[model samples]
Target: MPTILDIFKDITKLQRCSGNHSEFIAYMQNLSQKLGYICLVDDVHNILCKKENSNAKIVFQSHYDIVCLKENCVPEIIEDEYSLSAKDSTLGADNGIGCSYMIALMYERFDGEFLFTSDEEIGLIGANGLNLPINANFMLNLDSEEEGEICIGCAGGVDIKAIFNNKKIVPNIDNLDLYEISISSLPGGHSGVDIDKNIPNAIKLLIQSIKGCDGKILDISGGERINSIPANAKAIIATKKQPKKLIDNMKIEKIDTKSEHLSIYDDTLLNYLYSFKNGVRELNKELNVVQDSINLALIKTNIDEIVIEFSARSMNNENLKNLKDSTKSDLEKIGCNVNTYGKYPAWNPDINSFTDTILNIYKNINSKASLRAIHAGLECAIFKEKFPNLKIASIGPTIKYPHSKKEIVYKDSINNVFEIVKIIAYNLK
Candidate 1:
């Protein structure tokens, strides 16, 4: 039997995300054969493995899908201890770490149900599909971020996609060209925690500058999901006439960002205007710690108007609010209409969780005790509603920068989280 870290590494090799996990699901079933545990797959591909005689039932939920594959997903052992690293692609640590953690428990003697669901990325389709028996009394969710903290509550989120009813923008032969205006290089991060970083929205700022330039608005594309901060966006504008004073005009004067010319802007003023709004630059003084953030989530445009979707989040709600408010106000001041939607409540943790029975076992093993809340979404709220009598606790080791290209789970955290689950499965009431 492979160790927890080894299992984690193996999982990284699977492509289990959204519409892409059927193969990985089969692989997980194959592993179950070694432990004499028959994996049951639901119509929706949710998998459950059960040990019948266990006194209490603790279900661990995780998704088998990854957001996407990096350019070259060559898995390599990092730090020599264990776990795999990939080039440019996401390591799928967001929930793959959770899957490996639960898999470890299912094989060995366990005191409860091991639940590994799918479709968590696109939506909570897998877990959302389950019809549980009344006997399922407890849940320990490992699909959380950070190392020591037990996730008690989570924000309920909805991913929004809006398309502008745009007519094709015909370029002006008099002076029409596909000019690319982009806000690049800002440290994009998880939409919830990093949203409050006061970082510039690339699509939003770009639209403002492009609009200010008053060249014919042609085609605009921006962000993808409401959950992610858009890092880079490109747009094309037609220029039958580029005024000289547009970028420096009174409208977008407050933006501290820059712009360039692909000969797309007829007005040199648009260049000077863009030169002012250098949007989305990294100001992280702590190197990789990511103390700052930006929301460049989406970009879209129509012949008449351009729309960019943006979300801002910070561990600090006050700061998050301030940044969001500022961005909205600034955009509107420049005549760009801004709207907000699909807002959810943030999940704050109770420092004193009664530790329940899980904490005692975690402590007995001398593992680090982590008590923190993160800026991500989970089913904690839904689970709490469905099983109000059940005591809920969530813990996972260092899965960082979820929902992005930089996603990775620390191999060491996988080991630590697996051990924690083992203790919970053994001692759950």
Candidate 2:
């Protein structure tokens, strides 16, 4: 039998980035059949592997798709004395480790359900569109990042898109200086969990740099994904004068280009992005976490249109609605076409018999183990809604800097959590 790290290495070889996980899906299905488990894949590509004659009460769930910073990213695993990471790419350990644990349990012929979801990084696409039936009374989500903590609830989120027309004007080549300003190498992170970390957003930074010089936009694009805080952004502009007071952190380069038309876009585009309510809106003293927050995720310019995408999250549904409504109203007020989709509901905090069972088992191993909720969106929230009667709790190995290239997971934490998972699988009957 392969160790967890061995299995993880095998998983890293498959390119499983979001919107590009068909290969991994086929791998899981094939592996399930080889392991003598009944494999069922849904229309949305959520794979469920069931053991024969298993009476276990809990289902293990993990999303297989990962956030890839670059195109066709297959992480190169890097191992140190105590932890595992990737070589200049996202490790995918956030849920890959979770999936590895499930596979390990299957090798033991553990009696339970193993659900591998798809495209979770883009939005909970797999969980939201999940049509497969789950008979387990409890679900153990393996997506949480923290190790000594069990998550009982998570923030719901919606992706907001705003688009507006741009009028182009032929630029007077002699008077304006065409330059490309870019920002990169900043520590981008998961939008919801790291919103309050003061990590600079590359899109926001690039805008601020251009706005400082009052540059006329020619073309602009930034951000890697909707759920990730942008680590890199760049823009092209026509300025009457060199940007005098540019943001010091970004890279500025003078690009000599032939004459072209500059964008005569609405001032509201800059104002909306500059003044948009970003970061933490409220602090939940009760939960000691960010209650509401939004990320200025992505920006792109077409020949005649500009599109902006943002993600908003809150710990409860009402607050999420308010956040969505206010953002929509603000965008509509600016005469931009706006739409919201990929919205998932919040999972209210609860402590049920199943959670108590996991909690007690976790505490027995690590006395510091505690119950908490995160500000980030988790597929468990969708599963809780889809399977309301199923008691759910989430746990995972210690992962730092998820959704970014700097992601790392502690090896000891993986072993610790695996021990707990094995106990849950064995004792739950």
Candidate 3:
């Protein structure tokens, strides 16, 4: 049987980004057949594999899709003394390692169901649309990043998009100089997990640098993924007077040609971006976790409209609703049309015999095991909503900087987590 690390290495070769998981699905189907396990794909392309007759009534769930940071990201493993990472691209260890654990457990003839979800990186789309027939009474979500901690609950999230229909006017080519202002090299990370880190957002920085500049916005675009803090942004503006001071990690280049169409509502757009509520709004003191937060994720300019996207998360549904409504009202006040979607409910913390069993197994392997709830969104939330009676807990190895190119998984942590998982699977009845 292949080890977890070996399986993870193989998974890195497949292209499993959101909305592009067919290749990975085919690979899993073929592997399942080769391993003599019954495999099926749901309507949303979630792969479910089952062993014949097993007393273990547990489901191991992990998403197969990853956030694509670069084009054709062929992950190159970088090994140091203690961890493994990729070269200039996201390693996809967020859930790839989880998938490997399930595969390894199945290969070892562990009697359990393995659910490989799709499009989880984008907004938990696969878990949201999951209609698979699950027979297990307990669920083990292997998507948590911290080691030695059992995640019992996670924040719910909603995606909000605001569209501004701005009037455009022609710019004079002779009077204005076209300059491209760009911000790069910001340490981008998972929006929910790293929102409180005070890491500068590239889009926000770019807009802030040219806030009061004498310029007309020609085109502006930034951010790659909705779940990731933007690391790079660029704006084309027609300005005669350059801004006095440039922000760090930002560059301004003067171009010879001028832009054809420019948005006349630059002040409104800048004001909105500057006044947007971002980062952690509230923290749960008892749980020591973020209770409410928002990420100004993306900005794009089209011919007639500008679109801005924000991700809002909270542990309480009422808090999430209030934040969403307030944000929508704020955007609408500025003459922007707003819409919110991809809303998933939070999984309230619950500790029972099932979680105690897993916690005991983890403690047996590592003496420092603890139970905690996370600020980030997890598929466990979706599972809880769909199967309210099912017991659920999430565990995984230590992964650093997930959803970014600097993502790495501790070498020893993978082994430790796998051992704990195997023990839980074998003992669960």
Top candidate when judged by lDDT against the true structure: 2
For residue 273, model 2's alpha carbon misses the true position, in angstroms, by 1.6
On TM-score, the candidate that comes out on top is: 2
Q: Name model 1 segments beyond 4 Å from true.
A: 52-55, 69-84, 132-134, 166-178, 182-187, 197-201, 208-216, 239-296, 300-354, 361-370
Ranking by TM-score: 2, 3, 1
Task: Determine which window of 10 residues in candidate 2 has minimal summed lDDT.
Answer: 240-249
Q: What's each prediction's TM-score?
A: 0.71, 0.96, 0.95
Local distance difference test, candidate 1: 0.56
Worst 10 residues of 1 by lDDT: 246-255
Q: For model 3, how does the per-residue alpha-carbon lDDT over 232-306 read when each residue is reduced to its tens digit?
A: 888887777785446678888889765555545546777778777678999999999999999988888887888
User: lDDT of model 1 at residue 151?
Assistant: 66
RMSD of each: 8.0, 1.7, 1.9
Clashes of each: 28, 0, 0
Model 3 vs. true fold: TM = 0.95
Cα-based RMSD of candidate 2: 1.7
